[model samples]
Target: MSATGAAPRRFRHGLVVGKFYPPHAGHHALVEAAAARCAAVTVVVAPSRRESIPLDLRLAWLREVHAGTPWVRFVGRHDDHPVDYADPAVWDLHCAVFADALGGESVDAVFSSEAYGGELARRFGAVAVDVDPQRRAVPVSGTAVRADPAAHWRWLSAPVRAWLVRRVVVVGAESTGTTTMARALAERFRTAWVPEYGRELTARKLATLRRSRPDATVFDVTWDRDDFVEVVREQQAAEDAAARVSGPLLCCDTDARATALWEERYLGSSSAEVRAAARRPALYLLTDHEGVPFADDGLRDGEHLRAWMTGRFRVELAASGVPVVELRGTHEERLATAAAAVEDLLAAGWAFTEPLLPAH
Candidate 1:
């Protein structure tokens, strides 16, 4: 409704088209405007096949960001046609792709922020609606985002932020301060952190055993291949959920790779499925168990095997080829070391591959 008490003008159907190299706030604004002005809006995400970001991923991110708007539909199509604004033949090729994506649906309006919006509307036989043509509403561009994602991070949606967040997993032997380190790092960075799901599962298993045998101790808490698989799946789900809402850096107490090693500690061997679930994180902070006195926390039973497990983690991490930063000395020292490594990581910045460029 307007201030004059008149209903807002709307069209039956509107079309929005973009490469969406990676959908930033500007792209979202265009779609939102179309959605508000049209009864139904179709957003055509047309990226070239040679583009770095996948078409499906762009579509998924857009859908996630605009989930509240049910009237907006997103479609992905690979438009590898050469981009030449002055070439009519090239424009025709691109329009053909966009038209095919529409599936014979008539568009009453074309909403865009590009100079080519009028031509696009003419091709679709729809009215041209320019939206934020100067980029004032959302002062960001895909090119700027691609060049340095961290600089333009504020303009990105949660899903896109999750995709760009640098995940750092803290893993080590029992009672080695992995949780403590992970928590401290999250606090230092003012970001979200994922707790070890396996620990919660352990507590649950112990409680379940107590129902049958009240005297069952941590020693009696048995595990199998399926248990490890469940831990891996839940751990990854938690990490992903945290990443979406986390700052540029996400800290984790442990990860699926650590779970595989734990599986070997209990079940005597890690399964192919368990090992396959391991994902390479941006960095690994291994808390050394050297001077840390073992305190039996009811759930921990690996006091004597701490040295062996630490060695195993070191070997596995080294073999995995992901960069590892071992934390030793007092808790404060370890935190400093981890923080320094993280600072270096953030300093490196994100590097997205260049998308398909328009012909000169």
Candidate 2:
């Protein structure tokens, strides 16, 4: 304990470096443990040659995971890449860059399992403590997160776990089959989904509210448009709040644009009120895989009408501003594509219920 004299008093800073591609369970534990012991722990989300994950997203995951924590700070890139370690001294240069960031602030401890990490800590006058490389005590590591994200979600921060529950809302025209597609996505991703709330409500209220046909009685289909519009507006707002709060991502059956289309097509004009509500979902998905058999919702016209309705549906959704995923192909093909698309979306960060929960 005697360097100059009894190892001096413990420093307050703790420097922890990591890639944090997705900030899995193990990383959270490491961070939590470090934050507990250090006065301030600066997390450097290390840069990658393969930027499969962008710096901003990596930071976002860290921020989302550790949203409430006050001691954490993120720094991703360290000097330039590759470090030209052929020179051997390049490590010192790279290490200097990191130390400069610390600027006169010396860490009481440096935590890492990498071989060079201990030496690096010594250079900075740190107490170089090794976190279990085998993940025996704290199972947090960038590699583990990349390998099995879902299985080890409990290793992540509680806030990160909570942020994952959302239903991906899928929107499409009547008979374009959003219900089936949404269900398919849920099955494919093995998660809970929120069906088109408006459609379900509309299906029940079709008889009570009295909707006008698009081509009937001189093509004036606006009768009671406000009623349907209002109903959809309410349901959308509810689903949105739920999605943002506790989401596995809602698989929406239709967007407000669908209702807007119905109003414009059948009611002769669109509702400005409903259109405003359309901006809720972070993203809007529209199914364009046409020619699927129509279910004849009692309000539907005779054969070959679904294609026309779907076209009108697209025209309306295109204007809603939420990024769209237009699905196309035969019904089965479309469903498969939709499922794959959902998988991709989930990979890209779709919320789902029953996802991995964080451990204490």
Candidate 3:
């Protein structure tokens, strides 16, 4: 079926070939168009070793986008095939590669958007069905997407978008509403949220410590470096797992950067593991300590130390070299600022522009 909804000459088998480095809407249109016209469609993903994403991942993205479309089959192998798209003289070599890749299957039509589609179709003894040869249907390409995915994010399939989803971590001192804001952001974007794991671990440790000594309080038991280290690891695991299940964005309440700061506050020193985990996120939404009244949950250190820890987060975030945007004002105002930052991230393809200081 063509994009116009008219039945093009039906073929027993149709072929669509591309590196599909990161399959965008143009590729999807080509596949859908081909699938509409052919009894069975085979899409090829040929990735070179230099491709940033592995070949298997590209295949997975294609599989996910074309899910439930039984006629759309994909072909990829773990072989270092030659990528000579520059010279037409190498066309025969590529034809042989394609023939071998397709197992010399009988093909009736070739669907593509490139000028070389005619030649590729001729090699297969099939007619070329060029869909959006001028790229008018979807004015985006893999090169443009790779250069700035967030800019062309709408041109991408949800599966591909999910793969490129950026993590925006909301980190701040106690009573800063990091949790509330993270949840709100996730809901706003209709994506997943990773809750602060460190809080849970800290609560569990405090409970155990308090139960062991009924007279002593939570803050009396000094959390060691290992405790913070475990928190960082577990936090990362939870974030990663949530990201897998998330859509185009994953909102994290807090990450290892906070763990590092807390480690410094409690243990007097942060470990290499904690510091490493505190590295750059897509962006950081830091809730400012000012204006917001400190609420002492059983877990909070107190109102006085809120500023101190907030200062420490700034120091660690700067030292860790991550992009940060501090949010102030009421909860709604902070949420708006954070949402705008996330929108900007989505527009910029999550590219990092600012320089970061080296970890000391």
Candidate topping TM-score: 1
lDDT tens digits by residue: candidate 1, 143-222: 99888787897898889988889999999999999999999999999999999999999999999999999999889999
Instruction: Report the C-alpha displacement of residue 66, candidate 3, in angstroms.
Output: 9.8
Full ranking by lDDT: 1, 3, 2
Pick by lDDT: 1 or 2, better one: 1
- Measured with C-alpha atoms, the lDDT of residue 11 in candidate 1 is 92
Candidate 3 lDDT:
0.79
Better of 2 and 3 by lDDT: 3
Candidate 3 is scored at a TM of: 0.66
* Candidate 2 accuracy as TM-score: 0.60
RMSD of each: 3.1, 8.8, 7.6
TM-score of each: 0.92, 0.60, 0.66
Q: Scored by Cα lDDT, where does model 2 land? A: 0.61
Estimate, for each residue in 1-360, the C-alpha lDDT of model 2 and write its tens digit.
112223333448888876665676667666775676677888877655454556676677787767677877776663344544345576676676676666656677777655556666776677776555568776566555555445555565544544444345676656676778877766766655556555455444554444544334312222476665776766666555545443344566666666676666556777778666664454555666355666765644424545666677666656655556677777688777666665665567532222122123
Q: Which structure is stronger by lDDT: 1 or 3?
A: 1
